[model samples]
Target: MKRNFLLLLIFVLVVIAISEGIGFQSIPIGKFNIGLLPLVFAIIITMVLGIRIFRKGIIKKIYSKENVNFASKYLIFIMLPLMARYGADVAPKLKEILSIGWVFLIQEVGNLGTVVLGLPIALLIGLRREAIGATLGIGREGELAYISEKYTLESPEGRGVLSLYIIGTLFGAIFFSIFAPVLLDLGFRVEALAMASGVGSGSMMTAASSTLVARMPELGETIRAYASASQLLTSFLGTFTMVFLAAPLQKFMYGLFIRGEK
Candidate 1:
């Protein structure tokens, strides 16, 4: 455990060093600037290292499978409380969401847009059970839990969702950082974008909100408040949608459009 903690600390410091080192280089899209290449590069490097370790059997020699599994499980124990704190931070500012009126409320409903958008695309692409799970699931812990409970992680569905969750965790922030600024340049209101950023993932919300706040410093607090409220709504309601609506809806869509039901 001490070794694992030391490794984790070293890993974080390396990532931070890389992020700062590469902070100056950025990709510019029109008037908007998309930085954070260092962060992205760090993530890719970590992924490549992990893949090499696992595929080359280096991981087994260096670390016991049980210890690795223990780290993976307990890491979530650390993350979940931080996430809940993010949700808790929204409590005082939640009424601000109401001030934005029904448009914010309506956008909250569109939090399920993943299932709506992804299922069709997955079907069109002729994805099967496991791929369907990745497509329909929002790629969060709640969705992961539901899928794991119903279908073990070794199942195709579980693998699908887990893969999506991994991808989402690694790149979702960078994508949102770029995408949010582009949307703003396209003339979307900050309120709408703030609410949109709250799609239940704290990493995503942080990325989007931070980018927007950097761009428009005057609206930083408002943007954060709206984002927090929207995120809270997503986290709260996303649970119900994943368990009751998303899974069933995906199955129904597959049965209706595709040939097999598994």
Candidate 2:
């Protein structure tokens, strides 16, 4: 166990070192600037290295299923407390969110637009139940929990949500990082973007806020605070939307459009 932790720590340090070395590189696209961070680069490096090592069959036991599982569990154990602390940090900021007035409410509603947009697209693409499930869900752990509980893990809906969850987990952050800055260049306010970033996923929020902060460092704390507050709002209300609104809306759309049912 100690050896595994030591290895993990070493890997973390290496990634951080590599990230810091190359973190300052930024790309200018027209009037918009895109920034990169060591954290993002570190993640990419770790993935590449892990794949190479795996393919080479080097240190196979270190990458064994049991070890991987243990590491995953350990990460969750560490993460949960941190997440709780983050929630607490954001709690005082709830009044700030409310102070934003109707904009905050509208943004919160817009956060669930995925379900609104996704269901029709899924039906148009000729997706059935499971695919619809995946498409309508926002591809997060909370959505996964709801889908799994309501539909069971082995159901088509479960499979759909799970597929989305995996895809979102892997790519959502990168997508946010790349696009948020571009959107800002396109004339969106940082506060609006920050609220948008909160769409019920911590990673996505982090990526989006990071991009904004990188581009506009002066507003870093404010951007993060708004984003975090928006995320907390989403976390609390997203479940209700999914259970009461999104689910039914998806079913109604699917049945009406695809199944041609009255």
Give the lDDT of residue 89 in candidate 1. 58
Candidate 2, 80-189: lDDT as tens digits:
76457557656666677677757766665664577678877776776677765586667787778877787887988888888888678667777788888889999999
Clashing pairs in 1: none
The local distance difference test score of model 1 is 0.73
Q: Kindly provide the TM-score of model 1 when superposed on the true structure, using C-alpha atoms.
A: 0.81
**lDDT assessment of candidate 2:** 0.73
Model 2, residue pairs in steric clash: none
Specify the highest-lDDT model's number: 2
Each prediction's TM-score versus the true structure: 0.81, 0.86
Q: Determine the backbone clash count of candidate 1.
A: 0
Candidate number achieving the greatest TM-score relative to the actual structure: 2
